[model samples]
Target: MKLYQLKAKQAFPISKKEAWDFLSDPKNLKVITPDHMGFNILSGADRPMFQGQIIQYVVKPFPGYSTKWVTEITHVKEGEYFVDEQRFGPYTLWHHKHFIKEIEGGVEMEDIIDYKIPFGILGQIAQPIIVKKQLQQIFNYRETKLNELFGKLEGHKNYLELKSI
Candidate 1:
């Protein structure tokens, strides 16, 4: 079995609390996600994020193809970090970790996602051509959207990278 990892980091000119408040809220996902993705929350987003909370979403990852994704907030540490694991989704395995830290003039947010695609070797072959590119686009859109929402930190370059493990 092959596993893939995606790591992204961005510094925002905002306080740690401010970043935490926005990132911890599940409803704000759609606001940061690309509109073309058709990301919509189906349920489990009425209140604040908490451990064991399950959130369901319907996403159109590609043209005319939609899938139901269910993820559980398995861990949360107030303003520090949180983890979400996929219960049911397109991927065979999905575990995402989000972290926030206070920096010099603002806060830096980081994301680490470890996932395994379905279909064994065929999925491995498609990883670079399709999955990697799609995920890169999604995170790119998110970075742009976040920059618009909260101004970017000066002299700090955001980064996103995906690699096999």
Candidate 2:
């Protein structure tokens, strides 16, 4: 199996607390995910995210319909960082580390994901184009979502709540 890894970092012009609150909220995943992907919260969004917390969603990258993906919060360190792993999803292995560092003006969020698709050689051939595109799209959508939600707070070191836009 070929190991696929992606690292992404984004600066949010909001307080560490605010960023943590919004990102930690299980419901916000659907809000940040690209609508075209058909991302929807399947469970436990009403509660705060913590270790062992599971969030479910459906994604349709193409026209055939949707597939369910579930991730569990395996590690959390308050306002600093978290790690989520796929419990049941469309992959052989999915392990993601989400880290948040407080910057001078706002917060920097970083994602390190290591995943492997099933299907052996076929996955290797297809991932170069499609899976990569989907990953980029997901992160791009997240950046857009952050700007839409906290654009006004850019460069602010502190915030009160993770209110929706």
Global CA lDDT of candidate 1, please? 0.97
Q: Candidate 2, after superposition: displacement of residue 107 in Å?
A: 0.7
TM-score: model 1 vs. ground truth: 0.99
Q: Which residue ranges in model 2 land beyond 4 Å of their true spot?
A: 152-165
What's the TM-score of each model vs. the native?
Answer: 0.99, 0.88
Each model's number of backbone clashes?
Answer: 0, 0
For residues 1-165, could you state the per-residue lDDT of candidate 2 as single tens digits? 588887777777789999899888878887888778887778867688889988887878777878898899999999999999998888899998888998767788878888888888898877877788778778877876787887734544322111111
- Indicate the TM-score of model 2: 0.88
Q: Report the error of model 2 at residue 137, Å.
A: 1.4
Model 1 Cα lDDT, one tens digit per residue, 41-129: 99999999999999999999999999999999999999999999999999999999999999999999999999999998999999999
**Clashing residue pairs found in predicted model 2:** none
Best by lDDT: 1
